[model samples]
Target: MDELIDHSFKLIAKILYFLVRIFAWLIFEFLYEEIAWWLGWCICRAITLNSRPTVGINGYDEATTTTRFVVCFTGIATIILAGTILAIYISANAT
Candidate 1:
């Protein structure tokens, strides 16, 4: 019985580890792509006149420098926070 319990625990742990890894990968990829898109938009807006005519917070000309800065900072901070959470979760499960 004890041996069976030990094996079951090991199997469950391995499954959890794999699931966590997949989840983390998907999350990070999504976040990184989003960040890249935002930063690219910021750069393109700052550099040239080639921008789509749209009116919103993300519009190239509609945003002030401070707004852009805040947006960029928020994106970066979100990525960092996600990384920190992933690290903490994985470490906690590793035991």
Candidate 2:
């Protein structure tokens, strides 16, 4: 009985790990890629057109800014969001 319980626990742990990994990959591929690419494109285009857009309260662009700032901001935002999500999962699962 004890061995069975331990095996069950191990299986559950493996499943959880797999789920988290899949979730992370999906987020990186879909959410992260979309936001990063869109931001990169917007930043490059703004730089090409010579516009100065500032970071809005929610990180939206009322106008635009330099390529460096745009890419930096987008990267930072993506990291922050991804980290926040990972933190939430970690904290929730911590026992």
Candidate 3:
């Protein structure tokens, strides 16, 4: 009887693990796309805001514009990554 119970528990744990992985993937998939879009937007807005539409590859100023774009992109990516990790932790513990 003890062996049977252990086997059943293992099966349940496996199922739960698979479900949790799927849940995390679905959540992160949407977030990943949104982050890509935000990165693009960040690049565009930085250029527009500073009235500097020139790109580095196309004769734009190298130092200032690139610095601004990289800073904004990195900040946004870091925040989103931290949030996603927090969400995964919460999801695992909640179960």
Per-model CA lDDT versus the true structure? 0.64, 0.64, 0.61
Better of 2 and 3 by lDDT: 2
lDDT, candidate 3, equals: 0.61
Candidates sorted on lDDT, descending? 2, 1, 3
Residue-wise C-alpha lDDT for candidate 2, range 12-95, written one tens digit per residue: 999999999999999866554456646654654466574433433234343344544556566657668889999999999999
| Candidate 2 accuracy as lDDT | 0.64
Higher TM-score: candidate 2 or 3? 2
Estimate the TM-score for candidate 2: 0.52
User: What are the models' TM-scores?
Assistant: 0.45, 0.52, 0.44
By descending TM-score, how would the candidates be arranged? 2, 1, 3
Candidate achieving the largest lDDT: 2
Q: Which stretches of candidate 3 lie over 4 Å from their true place?
A: 35-95
Stretches of candidate 2 off by over 4 Å are 50-95
Question: Residue 4 deviation, candidate 3, in Å?
Answer: 1.2
Error of 3 at 46 (Å): 5.7
Runs in model 1 with CA error above 4 Å? 47-95
Q: What is the lDDT of residue 53 in candidate 2?
A: 36
The prediction achieving the highest TM-score against the true structure is: 2
Worst 10 residues of 1 by lDDT: 52-61
- Candidate 1's C-alpha lDDT? 0.64
